[model samples]
Target: MNNARTSWLSRSPYWVLSMILHVAILGWLIWYGPVRNIMLERGKPKREALIRGKELEKVIEQMQRSVAEELEDRVTLLKNGQDRMATNFDTLNAHFQPFEENQKATALMRFEKYAAALKADQESLMQVLVQAKATKNFDIASKAGQEKVPVMISALDEVRRGVLLLSSDETIAQMHALAETALFKVEKPLRDIGSLLGRHRRLEREIQESKAQVKLLGSAMQASRDEHERVKKAYDELAAKRKAVLDQMQALRKVKPRNNDAINEANEVFKKLNEQYKTDRKPLSDANRKARDNKYQFDRVNKRLDECVKAFNGLNIQTKLPEYLQLAIDNLAEASALETQVIEQVLAATKDQADESASEVPAS
Candidate 1:
């Protein structure tokens, strides 16, 4: 019995060793594989996803900053432009006051007032833009379901309406005409003097010859001097008129255009005349010269007067006469352009910001 038990033990001994090895391996796996893996997972920071989220966060931050800076710059520009328009309105008002008192009031006076009001409105709109920027909540479309969206939309609508009201065609024409008339007034005297000088030369020459023939030389000499003095006086007066016109033109140029057509025309004319005046010739006719002087003076004055009449006749009623309707149109047009520019810029910046922000949002 002892020998049989020993034989069985010996045979089973290999199986026992194999079982022991298997158990040890299983224990090691539980300690260092499945259990260890669970521990590692619990301790891990989700580094890849966390890194991706952080990068997206930085991108969003950069987009916000870009939008903020752009809005700030736009607000600054609008404020400066509004201030300048306001100043121009004041200057225009002061300029028209004397005309009103003289009972020579043109539609221009009322137009200026309207223009001033329009500029004030623009300033107000700019203030709204500033407020919107400060809020950093310009997402009207996204916030449409919210109460704030309605308020924002309403504000924007009001601004649009105001702009439309200010930029009417009639108002634009009036402003253009006013500016052109002012410029024409400046050129009037110059034209008169030029013609007068030509006539004086002809008259003086004719008188000189007559004096030599009739022995009335002394009287002719005195008359020639008198004529010369008259011409000089007229020249001086015209020069003064030109200076006044130029001052007004400089002021007008600073004003915003209400209509492209009228403003552009006026600008072209103003520039042309201004250049012409710079090269204006002085009266060179000798008043003592015979026959030629008398004829020259007569012809020159007649030609100048004719030219003046023609120029005055050619003036556009819509632009030059200060008609109430025209002035109204111009004001409305200018306001519209200003508002449109502002709104477009604001929308574009906002859209760009939204796009960038969307791109930064992590994919689910």
Candidate 2:
């Protein structure tokens, strides 16, 4: 038994050494391999998460800057448009200055002023849009979603209200008036020219009749010759009168209404009519002596008729005509149509803005 015990003790030392080495290797592996690897793997995910979070913050900041820039650009465009509209109104108002008639001219002036007002309203709308953009930016920047949306919605609502005011019928009426003024101012001169033309035609007919009378009288006696001379003298006097009338008509054609392109065109028509009068008058004045003698009485009547025709020709009828008159009507119709279109656009935009604003507001 003693001998066996001694041999087992001797082998125990080797077993102990083997166990110790195994434990040391296992400890080293836990400290430097799996445990450390597990810790490193866990920390890697945390570090990656932090980097991704920073990247997301940068992306959000870039988006905010882009949105802000876009908002600023849009606001600037809107302001520029408003300013242009104001300039247009100023031009239109200056055009109204030429009107001698108080009633019509005053109406036109009022309309132009209203157009200016509409432009102001447009500016107001732009301001509202700016406010909305600011609020939207606030909401986006605020990571807390609940607080941001409502503020943005309120700003949008303000924009809607501004748009609604601009689209009303009252605003449209002003636009219509502006157009009517332009149309009326244009047509006034045309009507005067038409009247002058009518006068010229009458004078031409009388001159023709006098010439025919001279032809019927065919050289007969000394008395007839003397009568023919008298007729010629009378015809000369009439020709002078006709020439004066034509000169006056020509002068009138050159007269331009201030700021009205349509009136300018009507004035041009008058110029042509005056030219026709001069051409027709020259022929009658240059007729043969025999014809003049035969047509002496007729020539005098014709001369008076020519004078009347020239007077009528100088007067513009389009301006003189009623509102419903088709031939010489002005741009009022077009202006009214444009006004309606603007109103409709404003209304639609306003409604859309309102809806969007409503959508943004949180439910009570």
Candidate 3:
């Protein structure tokens, strides 16, 4: 036994060494001395970083050069501007002189001559305006000085051959009297017509409202009929379920009393399994419905976006939107359209399933 222990102990060290050597080799292969591809990958990010750093340095140098050149240009411009301003100051002088008494008198004489010319121009312009009113075309250069109204007094008023000329105020007052006489003649009949038209409009609106009410009542009647049919169907289903329950009870009563408990338990288990199936599938159904609805909304929004893009394309491309946004939008819109078609196919395919679900009645 002592020799056996000694031999075993001697072999244990070799086994431990073998395990340690194997572990060390595995560690080296996995982590420390990995494959050549891994080693290459390890250095890839570092190489990229170094390349990016060099590119950034070049960009920085270019920016510095541009900034320095702009600064130099601006400084040269400032120097030139300062020199130009200095030259202007040295070369230029004010030429203005104050008015003398004789010059003022000469200006007054010139003003008088201008005033006479201006009066003649004003009269000519007034005649031109009257001519324009007659011809229905006003040319500013027209030199006609004809009066607008027949002008015996050489102005706005006319003098008839047999009577004293009526002033404009008297003519306006006479026109007012004529207008009053005409209004008195027609006012009552116009009022009666306006009242009749208003009543007609009111009756038309009432007729429209009545038609709307009648339509609403028709819809309500239809809804009530539908509700009645649904209720009647529900009652019939309840009666059928009750009859089935009674039949099941009769069959159970005919069985041995000991087996009745087992049968009832089996029925309870089946019912529970059905309920469980329903419960389990409820979330899946809800999730599917939500996904379908989300797809529908996505399609709608994307369709609207497509329309907007179509309109946007009509705008001036040189001034409106885009660098790459239109391309991205078009791709997304196309994808959305394909997805919508897929959803439509899915819905069409599952329509029978939906109908079956609606038709199925739960066991009572």
List TM-score per model, in order.
Answer: 0.18, 0.24, 0.21
Question: Per-residue lDDT for 152-200 in model 1, tens only?
Answer: 2344444333333333444433444443343223223323333444454
lDDT of every predicted structure (CA atoms): 0.50, 0.51, 0.46
Runs off by more than 4 Å, candidate 1: 1-289, 316-364
Native-referenced Cα lDDT, model 2 = 0.51
| Per-residue C-alpha lDDT of model 3 across residues 111-140, encoded as one tens digit per residue | 334323433433444444444445533222
Give the per-residue lDDT digits (tens) of candidate 2, residues 50-94.
458889999999999999999999999999999999889877866
Which candidate model has the greater lDDT, 1 or 3?
Answer: 1
Name the candidate that leads on TM-score.
Answer: 2
**On TM-score, who's better, 1 or 3?**
3
**What are the runs in model 2 whose C-alpha is more than 4 Å off?**
1-166, 217-364
| Clashes (N, CA, C under 3 Å) per candidate | 43, 35, 0
Mark the 10 consecutive residues where model 2 has the least summed lDDT.
137-146
